[model samples]
Target chain A: MTAATARRDFPRAYGKVGSLHRERLWALRLSYTSLIVAAIIFLAPPVYMLMTSLKTNAEMADQTLSPWLVRSPTLEHYGATLENPLFLGFFANSAIVTLLVVSITMVISVLAAFALSRMRFWGSQTLATGVFLTYLVPDTLLFIPLYQIVGGLGLLNSIWGLVLVYPTLTVPFCTWIMIGYFASIPKELDEAALIDGASWPQMLLKIFIPVALPGIIAATIFAFTVSWAAFVYPTAFITRPEEMPLTIGVVSQLVRGDTFAWGQIMAGALLAALPPVVVYVFLMDYYIAGLTAGATKG
Target chain B: MSEVNLRKVVKLFEGGVQAVRGIDLEIADHEFCVLVGPSGCGKSTTLRMIAGLEEVSEGEIWIGGTMVNDIPPKDRDIAMVFQNYALYPHMTVFENMAFGLKLRHFPKDEIKRRVDRAASILSIGELLDRKPKALSGGQRQRVAMGRAIVRDPKVFLFDEPLSNLDAKLRVQMRTEIKKVHQAVKTTTIYVTHDQVEAMTLADRVVVMNHGVIEQVGPPNELYHHPATIFVAGFIGSPAMNFIPARLVNAAGALTIQLGQGLSVPVPADRTARYAPHASKKLLFGIRPEHLTETTRTDKQNLAPITVDLDVIEPMGMETLVHFRIEGTPVCARVDPAAGAQAGAPMRLAAHMDQMHLIDADTGRVL
Candidate 1:
């Protein structure tokens, strides 16, 4: 063999390549291996849920060692889950409440954030910090006190109660996120707009809102997800069956005392998670930017 | 065109930092007035105050006979080009140029026509569809100029607009701006720290230092007849040389005794200006180019000094000879064929006609 061919065949060649390249290759191999292993470990539970959702109850209960595949896949669970009047009602109520709550949160948060971020006013910085601090308060601890307030306002057992309560959890975080996002826009851009005869409202509408659309999208996703998957306040305040959102409705109606309807519960959980996933899929760039704007600006 | 008048304008920041102090200027119609100074000399703050971008702490600003203290930038009938070009990155060049006109509710056709005309004037018509980021730095600068031109405002404000370009492009744009000013003849107030730009582009230059007006005059006038010692030192490239000397009246002739036994008799006409200040110390100032290698044929009031040469830098047309007299370093521009060399003695005739005597104490020109 020629020297090049002989070296290639010997498998001990390319001595000039530094050790850093070999180390980097090893590191990349380990990273990919760990990444796939971690993904499988974390995803196994969800995969099992989906698998069980597709299987009949008989196949699901059959103590088979290999649970990855089913002899008979069925759509009974999807049909039953959709056909159930309570489930359908809860889905509709959840949709309406989540949409309304997210809408209200978006409107209030964006306006308040624009003011806090762009407008120079007394106590604005302090008020903005206070908004973030409010987000730090655990919802589990505040829901009890919020329940009495909601009940005192005669909004108990009503979707309005959940709608009003949902914003309490979402607005602070959303507004805080938006404030940071809006603040990241260069001050010169606004100054230019102002010099161009744009009023404060016009500056925000023409320059800021358009430039910070990504942040607003991320905040919207956050608020929508929070409102959709929220359980504590809704379960506490919304007691009526028809008024129930999906999170509490699935637990109360589908899973009874000692007889758990895992398929429907999993289906409801998957549907409840779908909106945020779809939103993130569509606007992941903005969501990541909104979350990391503080780091970038700093 | 419009005239801008500022009387006793002072700007004090919140932290008691005084940026502009008691600045008084009058820019006539179609005049290209340049406010030139080093950084922190209040030139920009003064321009911003006139543009209504910065609040005037104490002053009256009148544009075209109307006081505009509280009027906003938009109402001032002026357009300003910032140092960074400040073009809207998201907008196309056409849209960027059209923004001001559209804000005034100008007709669509008029806005388009004005933008197109400005684009043609700036030769950016083909680049109109491209965003600011798509254009080169010089192209973006032209787009900014086009935006200002499309406004057709009474005045234009340029805040160190060429500072962002490289040296070669800056020189080219300086000429471009001068030609544009000549074509439009709109009153312009430009601020810059580059003395070369001020000298080349300004109809009249305002030299500022430490929040005060050091001097104001035409470039050549400031170069030749600087009213103050600061202006003399600040105006020229290689700056005017300042040498301490003793002024005395001896034998009915006013003469200055420079160090190293050199004396220059002052002219009879100009000597009368400082005749009373005899026996006082003064600063003898002269430009490097004014010191000639050729001898003085008049043979009166001429000062010849022995220069201990440290280095000789030769250009094609002239040579810069570095030397010292009385421990103060000095440079003299001589013809390249003069055959001056390093570490050698050279004699230069200090032209008394082109010299200035400044007060040693207060630095006021005599």
Candidate 2:
């Protein structure tokens, strides 16, 4: 409640009223303090990376400058990273894997969601719960077992193996997101389509797809970001520098046991984070609408 | 236009709960039939069974002389308007109307012509380019109707189609629906819980209660000649009041004795018809409009009683007076100039000719 309203509720209690105003001031102070602290906590690393990526190597080793600021800014590392064929291959591999995995995940999730939410059959509820439950599995616990399966298929050190294991991380949650969107739609809409002579496939493509477009975009972001930033699966599956995605390639190749190429590493990290940031920025509204629609279905 | 028929249709849900208990009805070609009742009364369920949206646990549903028990809704050649309108939110009004015909593989020119014609018939031609979400509630309602009309199906099914509109819009749309029905000449079955809507829109009204048909007749017939006490009470506004009384022999004639020393002679024509139930407890039925402030007029079948009016509500066209008869609350409609006052004794006349005597034990009217 506002201070003015609180005072109006008890006009004669002078000391208590003072304490109420004090309490509100303390709350506002604490909230802004915590918010600034959180913003620093989340933003410090990215800012440091950008600052370091823009600094010359001489400024980095000089030991007389603030590490957070660049005295002389240059784009040398960005140019050098782009020119390196190995780094370019890493970018290409990450893009290919993300594209394939996202397309595959979307197809599987949208169909699974439609069947589970609309064409409900025996055990469908159990199956839907099972799909969400799979998303709860941590990647650290899943990687070793996936390692053996990748080795058995002879896809070791291949980006193709990463393509196979990525959907395990992406599909279950995408399907869950889509299921919430599908279930939120009113039941009568489908009944209307049925009376309108729409066949099952026709109903899905024309009605559910267009109506639930926001959910689809949200799920696409999930798949895109997950596959693009995946580290554990690619670390376990690929060993060759050329076969590695950007996540594994930057970390493994940019460090030589003791010395680090800080500039190239920061440049690579920023580059790797760009696509997801772009996807998120361009489609932020749909993502929020999708998440809320799923949450408030009932 | 094609006739629709239902024979012994039943809807038995899972867990042994019955929603509809084997009721039958028939609507003539081009007839506007309405199924109306209180909520959970199976009126909508019966309409769904006819539209093939609900399975009829055991009976035949015939549309245009064809049994459709095994047919899916898409193949049933019927269109239904939902209470929520159920217009496809993503589609333009024109596309929503044409989706059905497009699915049936109608040519593009034919689809456009049909959509345009239906749009004009509903006077929603300007709204055809807008999405359903962009239109007002009444406009969305028209788009839904346009979607149904463009198909030109064998039968039209409407499940409380106008329940979402405000009262003024509901009355206006009620007239709009009637006008459209006249223009289309399609056999339609509509469902609503509002009795006023049923009375105004239906060529035939079917009153349902507790999974069974209570009565079926034209609106005026059902109002004037109700066969059961339930129908009598359900058919009128302000409701028909039922006071506990007894059909007794009064000086070798039949008189219904209401307690508090109030009694009225049965009209001569009905005395022989009611004689078999003499000396039995009965319910005296009278509509609020039939009970009014007494004046010097034809007293052929008039009965007078003085009551202490408890509440008087002045509705511009008529004043309603409420009081109790032997602890049974009752209401009467009188001329607004009748000077009804609360807590004042007033004499009101009840027309005995329009009165009904119901058997209390069986709820049957004589």
Candidate 3:
């Protein structure tokens, strides 16, 4: 049936004149109130952060009522933070580790998830549920045990050690996302590929991976953000000044016997937070799509 | 194109549920064979088994005289059009058609040539670069057919490819698919529940019930002389009316007595077939089209049929009268020109020449 015919068949009921006008006014009032409340609640912290990042170390200490709009906005703090060689090294180190971790997580999860979602064998259902549940286990609970394992492996004070440990956290979550994505692909598409003379590997690489690209992007964002913002593991495993990831590397150097570089510290934090923020800006659609797949496909 | 053959093929699923009971079939090269039945009657399972998508729990399948029991679907040399038109959603029509050839490492030019040829045949040339998501349902169905045709496989398997289409588009695609089959002439097997599709498309229709083949024959054979009661009932729209009766000999001719002071003569040729089984309870089968409005002059052979017209459905060319008889509900197709009325007595002339009689107990033709 045509949409026009369907519309004619089930005509929309019109509200009475009094209620219709009342509803419009009521909806407008509610929308305006929510927008104002939301703007303040959500934008307040980031605006404050922007003000703090703009201030000099002395201005930050000065108690002022209107701290949000800096009277004299200066780029000195940005310059100061950008000038530190050690800070630059930390930034580079975070980039390398997060990129490697995201790449590794995506590759491994895509393969593992395709297998778990598509291939059938004994214990497959158990193994898939087990993987998703593993992601649910709090990372903090395993930090001590994981630290001990890293110590035993003699991977202390190394970025490689952080890279190795990051996958343990990212793989399960990313694989879970990918499993849902791969499962949502209609079973017929793969059957078509299989009958098209594609082997299992070909089916995954050619058909599934391309079709589930949104999920892959979401998985990558999750892996990259988790690796970039990881504070506990890097702090526990890397003690050497040169070995620290940027999150720890910046904070540890900002303190010199309690005489902290507050301006540089916020600057470094802002810089360290930039990549994930940028990633979300570029791929928010896929991130939201991938997240919803878990709820719907499950 | 290869002739497809199955020898006692059975598919017992993981939970020991037999989706397809033992089935044996053979299709000659370039023949359009339709496996048709109601949903979950093992028709799709049988097609999937022949495509090597499902494993045979027992027996063997041969495509082009090669035993393919252990082979994966990729090596089976078959192309299947799924009910959902399983075109790769991510790819354009060109890529969807080219994927199989690209996987086989077909030369780029050769792949393009084959795809273009199939596209022209399907008249989807203008839509080649559009993704399946961008196309209408009928366009997507044509793209799916184009994809199958580009493969040039040994056999073509269609699993109700037109089920998703609207009625008008379905009828159009039905003819389109038939024309494609005629042009390609690949050994084809189509599965559908609509008997009209089976009758119009198949060189031979395999009617199934409860995972078992009820009957297999040409469409006309099935319509005129069904091998069993299920086939008789399932093969016609406004299905064959089965009236309970008793077979008896009256004055040297076979006659069926309907209990309600109504008796009709059976065909003379079929008299000998039921002679050995006289006085047995039988199910008298007759198609709706074979029953005409009884005129006074033709009352000699007409059986008395009383129907309390519950509903009247007019389809332009004919009118359908649904009512009850012998305490059992039945449908009769009658001429619209006769202007049958609701809640009124309508006399029907049950044509005895085309009437069928079967043993009600065993459901076998007597």
Candidate 4:
């Protein structure tokens, strides 16, 4: 009401606004800095791979050539990797194995998750936990037994060997993720469906499967990435290049006796990693949501 | 329409939790029966048993004269509306309403006709194309009801379907549900914790508590003549005020003695009812509305009492006056214009004929 007090209040109000502005600026600066740092950390390996894939073989061999710079950018390595019958075979094998494993994982995991979560059978909870615990078992520990089993089945040098072993790694974790997603769904939806004349399988197909698409996508991504990048089982089971998945095929066939075809290897690795990366880029929200939904709900 | 009969049905959940214990109820065809109780009182479990959702652990459930103990819910010919509405989030309202009919392989035109008819009945016709996420809570509830209505099943089950809406919307939906039920004339079993909803919607109210059915009668019957103390306490808002008293026969008169020289005469009609328990401790149950400011015209069944007021809550039309009668707190719903004040002595009268005397030890109404 007085001029003197009004002037004092004006500066106090300005100070409050100034402090809020500074706080907002600090938050923005901190987020931007951390984002850039994270981007560099995550992008560095892929960027290096792309650069290596573009380098000429001569430049890669030159000792003075900077590893990060492709002085002579060439599509020669991509062309070579694509044209090589061995690389093409490995790529085809990986694609088939990944597709089969993903489909099998989704079907088995969806049904298992539905039963374990919704059906109130004896020991269902214990069985669900057991599935998750099976996933927690390290793959290295099971490789020897798995090897004997695969050999005993007389599929030692077959792509089917990898398919059989891949599910062992994919199904348990995928089922666990699905169980969490299914459990997070309100129980009433399934009950309502049941009252609406849906049998158990019908309920899963009509309601649970459609409602839990994000979790399914997340599980699919996990299954595909794991099946595509599988190394231990393929290396242990298949010594033949024809049956080796892309991961083992590339590493075994390209680097012969310590003479590394660095450009072609990087090119093959980059190409192999493309599917999952593209999947993640497009479905990042669903991936994170599914993962966190599993953790929190479970 | 078909009758739903539960013959001593019991639900023993895992770890020996008995949710519904021996509930024997027969809902006649086209009767609107409501199972009302407090939380954990097995009302919802009873409805679920009739719907074939929860397995009847120890008894037989008969719907339309057929024992349904071994039948799955899908074959039971009943439709249920869940408290959460349970509208499929991914489906449009039309899809949700048509799901049951499609499952039964009804003709597409028939399914459409049923859905449109039910949607119009619930006044949710325009929302048929919208997904459940795009609708409000009340709209979703209407869609849930529509989903059930389109089935034209033998029985309809509602598991506290209106519990999730706001107060105003809940009342509005309550009336809409009543209207829908009246129009369809299907045997319906509704469950809710709110007694008001039960009283308003049910032709017969089954009051349950502690896994047991305490009383089953018309809504007014349950309110006016509750069989147990729990029913009396559970079926009213602001609840019935219970005062510790003793029925004493002294000098050829029947009266209930309050503490510290306070007594109210029992009505002559109830004199013989209280005569046998003359010396026993009892609970005197009086609803708040029965206690009011003493007026000159009040003569029959109005026993005047004076007490020091503790608090006053004016609820628009009526003011709730809190007071202590011989160290026991009691509330009287008085005229708001009576200008009752806190900490002031107020003259009030308890309606003697409406008072309930319960055996203190067994909690059964006398």
Candidate 5:
């Protein structure tokens, strides 16, 4: 307790505390820096799209104008894209296809996930693994056979073709996400529900669905985004302008052969990407939680 | 009519894991029966079978005199409270309690009344508006009980519902559950690994081990006259101490030879029962409370022994003196004022009448 010893020990203790604080500060700075760099890298393309979408056709054609900057920003491109009948038709097509596909995917995946996770039938585990493996099959590989199925059914130029094929892509992955989420729920919840006089279907609608809402939202987002942006099937099957989705229609109608209306194209692309971006911005927490819950809990 | 009877019920899970072997139990109406044992002892599995959560692999389960082997849980008229509470996180406390009634298509007013009654019974009326996530552990537990009580099912199944609470909360919840059961008077089957919970809650305790029922009796019956060695060891706190001993007939009196030059005379009633094992090795079982500091004058059936105390745990009211007899560690609960010290020789008296002589080979009480 002497002043001599106190003075000698004080700096050492203070030094230890000071270094700990500095280490934490350095870690915070490093993480923030990396996050900013990552944000810039990822946000670059969207930012460029937004800038280009605001440019006039003449400015876009000018070689001297910086692509990153719209010297005279105009809403004309957005107005043009929105006013185009073909664009409105394609937007309606995407909406119908995305809504139908998401609804079907949710219904099918929730039931499939419930059966795979809780109901102990034979081959349940193998079937669960098989569902995930089916998702791993590339869409490019299935598009050829799918082309025949669409052709055989004489639905080559129909929006229904997209609806049918999109589920094949969306169901497996959505079911896999849902299965992990459902499996993470305590068995006791369902057991208590069962003992409380809830039938299997009642349990799903009342207990499982509400409890696994985040996973359902994540799956719905995946389905909506996937169907909205789908290109390969819509391009291969639906050759008619009226039946083409927003993704394929934008490229096909906006850009004539050897003629790229770059400003309108960028505007349409930005507009098309808006739905998913808005959805993700509003529900980013649920999306990330549902996705990581499967990996961590499993 | 609400009685549940399981006849030779067997549960063999996939991959050949025998969770519950053939278990035959009959729980009478309005009886609070507890199934207790260590984890993986098939106690929970047995309760699940009765609740129709797990299928009976071999035999029939009769609920209210009806063979319900093929009946799903919903049709079986049982309500279960889980260890984790299992309150639906999405629903308000009132909604969670009313969900079962709604599914049954009960009248809206009736459902409201039942939920309100149950919530008031559990003293969670103020919590009716909150979701399960907004409730604390004890509140969630009460909500879970309220969910079950609202149904007013034929049987109540509790799967260690209070195990998640802290010690003081567990004790509080324990009494609350008992009081609820008394008021409701439903045929109940509770499962827990805590012997104290079983001893306190059950009208009858069914002790299970390794997928088999070891014994079924009242708590005092299991304590004072455990039918098996496992029951003796599992049913008491600071469990009963066991010593390897040999019974011998010396001058027409049967005495248990505990160790080198140490013999305690067997009681007259037990002498006849242990006569056949006179020359055989046995396990001498004695609860810590039965052994005390030896006084100047020893009462009848109180055998005196002297041993070097290895450790003395002074527990305010009584001292737990730990020592070894024939290299086997033994504990004796002596008076705190006995002046017992570690590594010092101390005289203690064992109540011979309370001693149990178990067959060492079979682990069965003689």
Candidate 6:
């Protein structure tokens, strides 16, 4: 039966107000209002960033023009930022570090999750909980100790230092997400594969990986975003402009002793944010599916 | 050659819960055997041990004369269909059927031929290109069976595969599975809690309860001659009624005395057998169909009883009337035209020819 007929048969659930419950509509209106307010509050900064990136330096400094509006917009700041080789070098460094970090994190996390969830030994349960607990630790507190390890390796002023320390930020949470996905797969599927004549590695590659693709995509997006935008590790280790990622590179290079080039800084920041935004736009469905995997039956 | 033998098989889970306690069974080649019982009765556990999914804790499992206790599931040459129809969500139905062959490195053309043949057997040819998520529940069940049939393994195992389908679809698939097994002629072992499915599909039904086998025989034999009270009650629908009574020697004829001073004489042929238990308190077991309206004739063992009908249910072809025998509830399946009604006295003919005398202390039928 349709829900409308069900509501008619069970009318007390709709209350004495009939099919259109006034109290329900009021609750719905309040929820939508709060959702709209939350959306605007979260979106204001990006919208303002785009406006500033389009504005000319003269328009930005003018006392009469509103900072929110870009009157007589120019692409001069964008063109100048692209032409600067120092800016391009920082972008390349961030891209390479993110690529390496994400790959390393996925390898470690998938193997760790498969072992922790399926291959049981002593203390396996405790180890799985401990992996998630590490993700809860704030990275701000970790960067100080990680600096010593990176410095002890004699790699203080290098981009490799960020690559070395970034997995500590990404692996714990990615493994935690992967463990949830792996555990949710019914035990029968693996048994069915085993009966179908698949070895353990074959089952992992052909069955588990394809079945858990959404979780892997979600973890990849997380690792990419976290490594690309990471600031504490790079700032603590690398002082050279060429060794810096986009997060520390743009801020330290653009602002000089309170002489802030607001327009160029905004343009450079927007350019650096393009990759992750594109990733989210293309894979938003899978990301949401992965996050809500254990909350409901698929 | 493909017969299966379980010699004293046992499965003891951690912390001392014995799921299957040293049960022995022999399934002949190409015979459809169903292990049926209530939940947690070790029926599914027995099927899993044969499939090599569960380790045999204490005994030998021989399949095709090969003593497969050490063999892995892949090397054991068996295919299983799970209850949920564990089709890979990402692969098409054709690919799902071809997975076992692909894993074992069969040639591409050979895999395609086998998949096509199995699809035709299940009539799922049109659905071969669709993923499992796109199919209905019945369609998924068909694909799961198709996956098993494509392998041409020595034996087929099904673990309550039809429990997920609706009633109508389950019956349809039941006929489909029997047809497939007949065409393929593979030894098969099926597990289910449904007695009707067991009776309809199996060549021999194996009834299990609490980690042990209760009885194993053909369906007709089990219904006509159950060895114990559990089998007598578990086999038939509306179930067999067990009324408490006493066996007495009444002037050289053995008669059973029920609680309401109603006495039923044993048939003359059973006099020698029941005379030994003449003074023992026993349970008189009679099926509902055997206790009907007082209209049946030509039976020398017919005995009459008057009962006040407490509830009468007209079920189109047959009417089920519930009555009491000295405070013990008894059901009778009479013809719908027998004029049975509630709060009225009715006369029922008890077929003493089919009556069973049981030792109440031991639950064994005599």
After superposition, the stretches of candidate 2 with alpha carbons farther than 4 Å from their true spots are A1-34, B296-299
Cα lDDT tens digits for candidate 6, B195-278: 999999999999999999999999999999999999999999989999998988877888888776788888899989888886
What tens digits encode model 3's per-residue C-alpha lDDT throughout A1-298?
Answer: 6855655565452333234667899999999999999999988876777788888767788886467667667788789878988888898889899989989998999999999999998999999999888888787888899888988999888998999999989999999989999888888988998999899988888889888988998899899889999998998888888787888988898787988877777777888778888989999999999878757865
Q: Scoring model 3 with DockQ, what do you get?
A: 0.79
**DockQ each:** 0.42, 0.85, 0.79, 0.83, 0.79, 0.84
lDDT per residue for candidate 2 within B1-366, as digits (tens), equals 489989999999879889999999999999999998889999988998988888889988999999999999988899999999999999999999999999999999999999999989999999888999899999999999999999999899999999899999999999999999999999999999999999999999999989999999999999999888988998889999999988888688888888868988899999889998886778999999989889735667889999999999999999999999999999999888888899999999989999999999888887
What TM-score goes with each of the models?
0.90, 0.95, 0.94, 0.94, 0.94, 0.95
Model 6, position A276: C-alpha lDDT score: 93
Model 3 chain B is weakest, by summed lDDT over 10 consecutive residues, at: B295-304
CAPRI-style docking class of model 1 based on DockQ: acceptable
Write one digit per residue (lDDT tens) for candidate 4, span B13-50: 98999998888888999999999888999988888888
Lowest summed lDDT over 10 consecutive residues: which window, candidate 5 chain B? Answer: B291-300
Model 4 TM-score, 2 decimals: 0.94
Predicted structure 5: lDDT: 0.91
Considering every candidate listed, which one attains the maximal DockQ? 2
Q: What local distance difference test score does each model get? A: 0.86, 0.91, 0.87, 0.90, 0.91, 0.92
lDDT of 5 by residue, A1-298 (tens): 5865665777767555456678888999999999999999999998998998898888888998788987999999899999999999999999999999999999999999999999998999999999999999999899999999989998899999888889999999999999999988988889878877778898999899988998899999999889988988998998899988889988889987889887788899899998989999999999999888877866
Ranking by DockQ: 2, 6, 4, 3, 5, 1
**Candidate 1, Cα interface RMSD:** 1.7
TM-score of candidate 6 on Cα atoms, chains taken together: 0.95
TM-score of 5: 0.94
Candidate 1 residues lying further than 4 Å off, grouped into runs, are: A1-20, A64-71, B248-255, B262-268, B278-281, B292-302, B312-318
For each predicted model, how many residue pairs clash, with residues at least 3 apart or on different chains? Answer: 0, 0, 0, 0, 0, 0
Tens-digit lDDT track of model 1 for B20-104: 9999999999999999988999999999998888899998999888899999988888888888887776678898888777777
Q: How closely does chain A match the true chain A in each prediction, as TM-score?
A: 0.89, 0.90, 0.88, 0.91, 0.92, 0.91
Worst 10 residues of 4 chain A by lDDT: A12-21
